[model samples]
Target: MSALAERWRAARPKVAGLHLDSGACSRPSFAVIDAVAQHMRHEAEVGGYVAAAAAAPALDAGKSAVAALTGMTADDVIYTTGSNHSLDLLLSSWTGPRTVACVPGEYGPNLALMAANGFDVRALPADGSGRLLVDATAAMLAADPPAIVHLTALASHRGIAQPARELAETCRGLDVPLVIDAAQALGHLDCAVGADAVYSSSRKWLAGPRGVGMLAIRPALAQRLRPRLPPADWNLPMTVLQRLEHGETSLAAQVGLSVALGEYLAAGAETMRAALAAVGKLTREALADVDGWRVVEPVGEPTAITTLAPTNGADPQRVRDWLVAERGIVTTHAEVQRAPFELAAPVLRLTPHVDTSAEDLATFRDALADATEEV
Candidate 1:
């Protein structure tokens, strides 16, 4: 293992077996775990309000870290339950026409959320591989600009990293607000794409505790959002973006997120991205030779996610179950519901982090061969 991988493995002591499911949730580091426990203990000793007040500085640092990660100011960031809540908050608070331009492969729940909020969702121009075509998207925005443009920097069902920065630049030139769902891209890929707003969860690539996420909005766009709920007098001291945050939240999880963000920065963002991309390429190349399976994403795609479709009419769920039960390997069984417009059936998604080793990949290959033969 490299020094970085060694550090990652050391931090995650409880990661038993080969954990290739970072897309769902990563193994939280011991520092993050300890931070959560310490904060909960403090909350138990002190009142919740008092404990929160005492944690103000660390929480501020956390918000600053999020701002740094998303290319926004510290005052522009707010906490939410997760990506779903963050998107709902942004969509519900929109004061303009309920029309959103997004990629056809936008997350299924996001599509449902837009429908719930009465948004007329339209698909952005993309190539056959589902990557946004910058010039075509620019022309579409010029011809008929939607209320906002939304992009998932890295999708859940596939490993193709979207052209977020190009789209952001297009939106900027046209003065169209762009909102990005960075739930899968925050720590794994470069997230500072200059979008109007960016939101992500703590669990996936950040390796923080679950139940915490963040939204960062540009100051001008933040001023335009008109949430239906009446603002509290106490919230007036906060920035327009921060006003979206409700009073009740998990302080412990917030502290854990702070530690996790700190760890990512210490690990060097570029270094981590490079390592993950290399691992993703390795995973694709190694799995290509595995019989009875087909690698979905191209080997050159720069992402940490690799999806495999079973051949010979084999069920991916059964293979996933068999891997866990027999081989102690973890993975995700992605269904069409994950990307209703893009997928035709289910696939087995393997998302390994920096800690994944060559030995681990070989073990998975052998185990998957066995799984295909039996299941």
Candidate 2:
């Protein structure tokens, strides 16, 4: 077993359960938790409204930190409840025709949103390895044109990294609007993609508290996006992003998210990314020789997500349940619903963070072997 990152190890206390489900939700550092608690305490001390007004500076700082995380300015940032809500706000406000261009490995919820909003999905052609082909995508854009180009920077299952920068450049040349689902890539990879807009959840990878997400819109695209919500007051005018995030919000969650982003930047984003990548590689290598398991992600891809499927008819959910109940090893299941076109069957998803140690991964491997046998 290898040692965990020193900075992260000191900041994050040990957990009772061996947490390997960071892709689903990461454990926030003590500082982030305390920030949230402090806001709530302030609310209790003063009135909720008064407390929120006082916390406005901290809330604005959080938005700025999130904008920095995505290489954008504070004015471009909009806070939402989570990734799904952010995507809904963006998609629902799209005034373009009922047509969208997306890769085959599009996030299932985004696909569902497009269908629900009366947008027809056009699958872009991909290379043999399931990556979008630039020429073919351009050709598609030229021919049966779509109203918007949607890209999931990283697949939720199998940790497949998409060619987002290249696609962004292509979309810009084609004069098309590009929106990126950056939930998994925000904290794990280099998130500064050249896209018109990017949205992500705070819980994953960033180690921020749940119930907070971020949306960054380019200035040029901001005014073009039709405002979805009406102004609360007749005299008050709001920017498109402000209208999307209008009304009351969770002040405590917003403060926590800001702290989390600050912590990530202080710890060094590239250092955390490299540490997480090593953990993913170690997990894949450990399970490479395991009898009835197959690692889905290819080597050398910079991702913290590792997906494994049972090769000998072993039920994935049964294995997951056994691991939790018997071994206190927490993991998640990636069903076909996450990415229907990319994933063939249900997979066991193991997402390790910088705090994850080699010892923890070894324990998970042993537990998984036992679960496969017992269940």
Candidate 3:
């Protein structure tokens, strides 16, 4: 069998086990879950807090693992509950009368942060496809130079990754810091490690437990953050993390995230990227010919996400329901006009991780074909 064909065959059996609403199944190499499971068993056998303390070293090492994964320094990594929580912490650290400029269709809470922080918020128009025109974002920043310039590595709704270099380059000359919401970008795309702060949720692509998230703060900007926890020193790896890592953290989960992150990095972004690309490609090809289905192959060097929309006689939600209820094929759907693409419409996201096989894609394709018929 060909390389991709062999991969698909290997991935087929695992598909039967999935039950999540978002067809967001990544490759199985993210085995941190198994580790978490093991840790949980140990905790049950031992005491909860004691088990956590026992694993503290591994948990601490996991922080470093996250740093290596995202290209941020170990000291900059702060473990939080999830990306939203980390982003909220980062936004809270910034205050005062500052203008925040974003390409239209920016994520919700960030705009809310701008409004809540009393900073004037402005949005530049997006391209026809609702993608943030990187040049336009740069122009907006140059013309306005707000205290903060923000862009998402990938929009949560549309699966669109705003051109990092374009947005980052535009901010280069300005005093304002650039913040990239990397939640969707972490496991799927190559992180450039340029932004002032990058946040990611462990669940999406990292395959960690949903409760944990990571924030990568540039070491240079470490002093800039208004630490949330009182008078806590951030000089140490454990100390610097206090600024954001709120809530009761799961020791085993963190270790699992660390383990999963290590496995992911070892596979190398190149191998993972190639594996996901094959899956995304198959999804695009399979859905492309179906009626009332719009399949997007992003030009910003697309990731594992394959988006689908109805062409005619089908609302996106209906198509999604059909796929889920009838075919068991999971996916994301985006309307063409939302900036960051992932945030706009209900996306039928199909992320074929390294663990997904070509046969699974074939199964999904058959389901997609059947689902497109509209009952």
Candidate 4:
């Protein structure tokens, strides 16, 4: 085992989480939070402008660091409150000549947001495995060619890992612009989606704060994007992401984001991927005998997100509540039938981060066994 994995094992015993919404932070998140606290204390002593100015190097380094993490250029990155907002900025700026297309089973709101913004939304069908048909989606794009094509790197409702880069490449083949929402795939996959635009949340896999996220626009396409409002001085810091316009930003939160991204970078993506893979394997092994619990992802697709739920009416939320109430375990239940982000039904989402452990999964299983009995 690697040093990071060993440290993760040491940290796993601490959570004692029952509901097991372990997917979000794991352990890499701690380093980010510490950096955030340290930076905040230092900034407190200085004037706002002086503070931002003083931290400019860290901020700049942060931009480069995040760019490196995503396999993109520094200039292509734009700071936003989170992936949703980052996407809103991208969606609002659409000045396409004709169509829009998306894959089904993606994060729901993004599809509606595209339609709400007036792009002609088309849903590409998926196979029985819940994976999208990239060729089919690309065909739709080729027909009239959409203003944009989209894929969610990993579906929020279940641990379905979409073939985002595959679709992104397909879109590129058709010369259509693509946007990938990688909110859940950041730490799980080191992907270059080959999209004109991409978005991700810092909180989910990167272990950053709750509010920060990232937007990566290809340089060729970044220059073409217009915010909802007018542009501000580029050097002034993007206050708010206007579809094609610009606005003010959460300076402190952004600083925290940079810190978090740096901490993730320090660990290296390969190390993180290995840790997640290890935990996911352990989870599959631990829950092998549980009859009701259904593991979402197939063995071939590598993902840390594993879901366990009652085979019957067993309300997922009640399960979530029971786990936390009984064992202080934090997790979410999935109801794929609903959407618009917040309204999306909760699923028993279990994400093991770069620091998760076999022991953690075992303890979690024990808690689940207990939770399931009363239900």
Assess every candidate by TM-score. 0.97, 0.95, 0.83, 0.87
lDDT of candidate 1 vs native?
Answer: 0.91
lDDT of 2 by residue, 1-375 (tens): 334366666677677789989899988889999999999999999989998899888888888877776778888998898888887888877766868889887888888888887888989998765678988888889876677899888778878788888888888988888888889988788777678898999899888999989899988877666654683445356678878884576878888988889888887778778887888887787778788898877866678788888899998988999988998888998889988877778989999888777788878888888999998
Indicate the TM-score of model 3. 0.83
* Shift of residue 201 alpha carbon in model 1, Å: 0.3
Off by over 4 Å in 2: 1-4, 231-236
Score residue 208 of candidate 4 by CA lDDT.
63
Q: Write the per-residue lDDT of candidate 4 for residues 56-166, one digit (tens) a residue.
A: 777677668767766788777767778778778877765555356665565676766766777776667678756888766666667767667777777766666788778
Better of 1 and 4 by lDDT: 1
lDDT of 3 by residue, 142-244 (tens): 7767777777777655555567766666676675787787777776777765677788877677666667778888865666666656554544454445645
Q: For each candidate, what is the lDDT?
A: 0.91, 0.83, 0.65, 0.67
- Backbone clash tally for model 2? 0
Off by over 4 Å in 4: 8-19, 25-31, 231-247, 337-346
| Candidate 3 whole-model C-alpha lDDT, 0 to 1 | 0.65
